[model samples]
Target: MARRRNPFDIFSDFEEMFEEMLREFEKMGPGEHISGPFFYGFSINQRPGEEPEIREFGNIRPERGRIEIGERKPLVDVFDTDKTVQIVAEMPGIEKEDVELNVEGRELEIKASRGDRKYHEFVELPADVDIDTARASYKNGVLDITLNKVEKNKGRKRINVE
Candidate 1:
């Protein structure tokens, strides 16, 4: 007979794995210093008929008992609608003035910096958006953005043959 597993076991397993990794990271040689402001996190997406999607974002990477740090990639979610595209990002401890956004064609770039915390991410939009119709708001560590989709030309242009 097969044994059933508890759903809460997932968190315990993840905690144990994280602790083991931290222990391994601490085995570095003397004079090797690990700097602060390191961050690592992951998000899980579950759908009714699809496999779970796991995404990792952070500036710090744990490799061979060493850590490498860079610009943090903020966790983001994009929703495409018939008339618009919405983007939401989580960036805590940052003021609204510190954030910057740039849109080009079907791409969007987000960047922010505050003290020791910095974030940067480039997202490929699902459709072309009207740059002049963008609206953004930030409150309580969450940034919300909406842009109108550019309408496609339905009529084909005729070319004269030589």
Candidate 2:
């Protein structure tokens, strides 16, 4: 008889959801964090790191919006391409309508609120972005933003006339 897949297995997809949850809390706001009592059985050295690096998402922080009964902090993902930078934020239990994206000079700003909770975020952009032509879109509890990189003149050339 063939063995059936166990949905409750530590390595199963169900457990992956919790892993995602932990990542979300790390990226969203500046607060305390704790590495999980993970059930996956992944070796301590094989995993990312045992250290719980708590980061405070500071710089132009937004005011405390509101708080709900059972709400978790959001998650954020940042990726950069050759000529563009993309930012994706996951805000579950919150609607896209409550999220806001803004680009100032060379910085990217993101704000989100759900129920009675609000989160403010700021990301500094590389020196290759044209804020005027940046684009942002939100769908399926995720916010996607693409910024175009600016073109600059190459380094100086030496001209010697003897």
Candidate 3:
């Protein structure tokens, strides 16, 4: 009778183990990777030079898919008139001094960061706007932003004469 090899011996070359897994998956079927249920996402945009967080391939619990992470949820409200576009965003725990607003052409950029929490979002205006004329005021845990939209070029009115 042949003696069973120790599992520790199989894991000696950890990196090479992934190749064996790939071969096994290929032999099963192309549908095997996505079909069996358990899945994890890999994001390349994580902080540079930081190793990704990996969880051991353990008991499969589909219920874990419901977990959500990241910064706190943000609330934004935008309204505009002929003269100006107004935006009010509610971001608690963020101070007015921490908020910075920038306008380039018709895009309004709001960046506010405090500690590990940050809120960054861009809003496109109805048309071009003057960045210099735009104003920002943050108070009462709400950011008030106003942008003076650029004046529309006057279109010639056509009239048919008989």
Top candidate (lDDT): 1
TM-score of each: 0.73, 0.49, 0.51
Which has the higher lDDT value, candidate number 1 or candidate number 2? Answer: 1
C-alpha lDDT values of all predictions: 0.83, 0.58, 0.61
- What is candidate 2's lDDT per residue for 105-131, written digit by digit as tens? 778778887655555667767556887
Candidate numbers sorted by TM-score from highest down: 1, 3, 2
Q: How many clashing pairs per prediction, in order? A: 0, 4, 0
What lDDT does model 2 reach?
Answer: 0.58
Q: For model 3, what is the C-alpha lDDT against the true structure? A: 0.61
lDDT of 1 by residue, 108-153 (tens): 9999999888989998899989989999999999999999999998
> Tens digits of per-residue lDDT for model 3 on 1-162?
976667646343433444544554566665544322232222122245875433222112123223222433345666778888888877666888899888776777777878766666677677677777878888888898887877876988888999
Give the lDDT of residue 62 in candidate 2. 21
**Alpha-carbon runs more than 4 Å astray in model 3:** 1-68, 155-162
Please identify model 1 stretches exceeding 4 Å from their true place: 1-27, 47-51, 62-67, 154-162
Badly placed stretches (over 4 Å) of model 2 are 1-73, 155-162
